[model samples]
Target: MKRSAQPLVAAAVLAVGVAGVFAILAMRPTPEERPQVKRAPLVEVMSVEPGPYEFVVRAHGTVVPRREGDLVPQVSGSVQWVSPALASGGFFGEGEPLLRIDPADAEVAVESARASVARAQSEAQRARRELSRQRTLAQRSVASQTNLDDALNAERVAAASLREAEARRVQAERDLSRTEIKAPYAGRVRSADIDVGEFVARGTSVAKIYAVDFAEVRLPIPDSDLGFLDLPLGGGPGGGEADGPRVLLRAQFGGEEQMWEGRVVRTEGEIDPRSRMVHVVAEVEDPYGRQLASAGSGSSTPLAAGLFVEADIYGRRVERASELPRIAVRDDATVFVVNEDNVVRERPIEILRTQSDRVIVGGGLRAGERVAVGLSEVVVDGMTVRPLAVDPQSRAPMDANQ
Candidate 1:
């Protein structure tokens, strides 16, 4: 009886356990049948603000002088005096004496010329008096015709001699003036060779110098960049003065970076055959003038010669255009514009120009429209997106929490 009772209890426990498991399964909630929901991608967007935008083209070049030449002496002589400002890297004023050759020979030549002129004048006067007296005598039948002819010839010869002496005198004066070499313009000396007591020949290059009134920079830009610049195609003033497009030059100077203002002065006469680059000349007036000092909170710096600088040239102004990040535009010249409902669709845009970092759009988009940025090629039309507003300059999300 005990063995039968044990089997019966075991069977009862197994049945109870199975019933409990079934009861718990019945109490569980049933799986609900529903349609799948597509997940929308998160995208960064920028608001298009179409307005007048002056394009900026970047280029780099070395600063140079608008006018540079070798300082040569027109008259040969021993250098009796040398200007301190005639040395290499020296500054000088316009018409300032750079060197003084020994003027002893020049002075002697002038004296000799003056003496010749005086003698010629005396002879000419005496011959004129003699010719007049001979004319009177011939009219009175007192002098022979041969004698009157001789007097006339003497007067003419004296007059010619006087003219010759006067020419010599003028030449002597010119040679004297050239003995002292003066600066053609206010400039800095690039190099010098002669010194005091050194004999220099005529037309010898004693030094090399350049004008500092206007510093020039030859900026080489691609031929494609020509359309954006209002350069002087005729090599005239179209690229200069206040009317020309402005330029901002940046460079490291005095152990710190500095900025300078200039303008496009002109373009080179011909394109570079090998590079197809068109070099544009930029001019800055009074680079070393007083305007550089205390001009703008100790920030106005002079554009020195030979300084390697980066140029940001202001180009053509577009009446209505928007600058978008380069990644925003697709290869097909289309952009993804996100609507108010967060639906993105491909829209064609008229691209004016493409730069390394951005694209200048001329048309095909309205102001205040959100343009998707940094989207992948896998983007499809009518795709849903979670839009995030971003800064125009930095492209960072405007919301701090983002």
Candidate 2:
């Protein structure tokens, strides 16, 4: 009994010691300290500077010739000669002979007509002489009135015959001239259907050609973008060709990038039924001219037909417009602008235009104010933020690491 009582007293003492230690630890005073406030989140920002900005409308289209036609023959005969430049991809000038038909038949017909005309002229002269003689005889009372009438009738018939011969001679000359097939304009041959010694009929297509004087591209502009462009749509009041907006076309040619300058000539009269888009025609003059080929650096190439290209239409220049990164504008047309105290305040902004990389603000921003760009955290109105200011000129981030 005594040993059991001693073990219980020892266990009770250990328990009391452990409880006392915990109680002392809980009662002990710690060093006095103050609570800390959370630091503001760091955000990169850019200054809002409203200034002159040139609006550019981007579009794409296929290049095509301004004038395309099929070369047809006006006169038919066996081909006597074919110009070397009458093949596919050959270039020729206006009125240049592309082919010559055998002039044997036409030449013979012309000679026959000429001889008949000569014979008719001689007969008409003889008849006139006879008529004069008959009139003199009548005045001298040597010829009867019936004889005078017969002489007049013979003179009239001879004059009609002479006119008929002259008409036939002129027609023969015209047919002879048409034996030489000529190019109607300065252009490049797209194809050829005939060769030397090959017979062709009149009004048959010989080749396909397109004028190289100018080219056109039909660009589809969205209805929303129409406000940004001053196109001559439906001949509406958008200004004349002399003061039309300029367009720059870019494309890959000969394994290199090439650029061509053009102008907005006109727009489609109505919206396309399928796309509901307005197509504007841009004209590039002298597409094949050496001056145009050398417009850019490096060896330049011509803007050939059927080439796909991108176009940049120069639009109106907006003055004092605020330009901001796309991320700065929210869905509700509001931006997080950093106030003077470095606190983010949500402010409404008028979006004049939206581009691929930036947004043009028409109002609600000052020249020197800072707007938060690319904030990683969820933004709240009137949230205090540490703005890492960005230089307007260099576009470098300031206090970025904070």
Candidate 3:
């Protein structure tokens, strides 16, 4: 009975061990239970457009009066009165009186000259009567020829004295008239340096005036641009022109667009020593009283003297050049162009001109080629890209990868 019990216990222990081994095998991991990795998303991008480009140059310049003059008193006198409008930044018309100098002294000189002329005239009349008497005595044989000749000479001397006095009087009158300082041309007064009761000397500057009929804009072009500029090689209107190149100038100021029709007036004859640029002058009409006034009136728009301005000189327009958005151009003058296979090709370009928002390409681009606009990424040659099609109606992105 004990032997039978022992066999029964051994069988029960073997069954328990087999159950434990099966549980351990179920909890262990296999090769197929490991975690799997996720792939990154593709970078969505836009397309590029290609076309003709142009070359352009930019420069800075200043505005100046077409005609400027200094107001100087020709005659010396004490200042009697100054014009109510005579001050810095004043405007006046042509021939307007800017200041009045005391003319009393000049007038007195004139009067004294007139008295001298009168005295000389009286002496000449007495001499003529004496000459007549001498001639009669010589005819009657009562006087010698020498005595008559002496009398005639005295009369001639008196006549000469009277003419001299008359000439002095005329000069005195001219000096008196000059005591009033008048404007030389129609313009605005830049400054009035004299006032009432101030003593002014001859040839002293009393004021400064600038003509407003027209204004001048000076542009500095590099020596390289000299070939494209149609400058007057010879002198003509401003000097003279012997059939030189002609350039068109378009000027914009204060939100208003103005077209000034003029040719290159002249060059500075030499390059600037400091900037190595040649100064070119262009004449612009100030018809709206923007630059100057007819009389001493201030400018309505006040294009004051020495104002800086931007000038655009229209060079030869390229008929076949393509226009592109400025952003399409890279720093190395290369652009991303989409080929027929939708692969981006980085094509090198030559920039002709860069306007406000567009660039004109001169080389390495043809008309009607698709180019990228406003792209901000590192684009390489033959890179696969999805071009976002642009909607013609709304100018917005229509679809991705079109």
Candidate 4:
């Protein structure tokens, strides 16, 4: 009787546990359904305006002199005197004497040549007088034909001697003049390696100098960029037309940023073998302060030699082209534009020119179109976007934050 009652009690306990589990499950509430929502991407956009645009090509190179020459001595002599401006880094005017070699020897040489010339001239005069006498004597039959011939020969010899003497005298005078070293042009001395009493030989370098009126820089341009610049590749100044396109050079000097104005003067004869790039020469006038006084402009910083600089060559203008920010242009020559329905679509563009900060498109874009300049995420065609317009004057974008 006790065993039978134990089995019935276990069965009753299992039924009560199952009923409690069902009651807890029924008391819990179900989650409510929510509607699907899509949010549009926010982007900064600029209006596309087709008009005439001046393309500028960028390049870099080192500053060099338009004209540089070695100061070579023409006469061999000991340095007798040195000008104060003959030192390194000294400034000089054109035709100013920089130094003087010992003129004592040169003066002596010139005097000796002059004496020889005088002697030759006197001999020539004596010969002429003798020839005249011979002619008269021959006419009277007192002098033979042989005597006339001898007189003619003597006169010819004397004249030759005079001519040789005159040539020597001229050379001697030139040497004497060469004893003084004069500046060939207005420039600053790059280097000086001589002093008073120092012996120098002819054809030896005395100094090095460069013109201060203008400076030159050889800018390397890629072959693809040649079409944009109207460079004088063959040579000359546009057949007497206006000067080449204007250029602006930038470089750091004296711990501050500086800019120098220049123009495209010419291009190198051949392409660079290694880079396959065409080298263009740009010239900056009044690199120093010398020309400022004449132009009625204040003195400004000069573009010194060997300063590495960046150049911008302003090229031909094109009409009916769309110019947009560089960020708006995709790597595949495509741009994201906001259509009338505020949807971003990828459109193919005919790229006319590309620059560091901007891109010019020749086709597939028109005026009154809005181009998305910057996007926060990957974009697809027909994707809805919230565009923030940019002001042309301030170049700032107007958005919710603004």
Better of 3 and 4 by lDDT: 4
In the range 1-402, model 1's lDDT, one tens digit per residue, is: 888799889999999999999999999999999999876777888999899988788999999988999999988889999999988889898999999999999999999999999999999999999999999999999999999999999999999999999999999999999999999998999999999989999988989999988998899989898899877777856533666668899999999988889988777899999999988888888887634443664434667788999999998888999999998999999999988888888999999999888999999999999998855335678987778888979988885212
- Backbone clash total for model 1 is 0
Off by over 4 Å in 2: 1-34, 127-157, 236-240, 290-299, 390-402
Each candidate: what lDDT?
A: 0.88, 0.87, 0.71, 0.87
Worst 10 residues of 1 by lDDT: 290-299
- Measured against the true structure, the TM-scores of the candidates, in listed sequence, are 0.85, 0.82, 0.64, 0.85
Clashes in model 4: which pairs?
none
Highest TM-score scorer: 1
Q: What is the lDDT of residue 113 in candidate 1?
A: 96
| lDDT tens digits by residue: candidate 3, 148-207 | 998999999999999999999999998999988787776777777888899999988877
lDDT of 2: 0.87
lDDT of 2 by residue, 163-199 (tens): 9999999999999999998888888989998988899
Worst 10 residues of 4 by lDDT: 393-402
Residue 147 in candidate 3, Cα distance off native in Å: 7.7
* Residue 223 local lDDT, model 1: 87
Alpha-carbon runs more than 4 Å astray in model 4: 1-34, 40-44, 240-242, 293-297, 325-334, 344-346, 355-358, 374-384, 390-397, 400-402
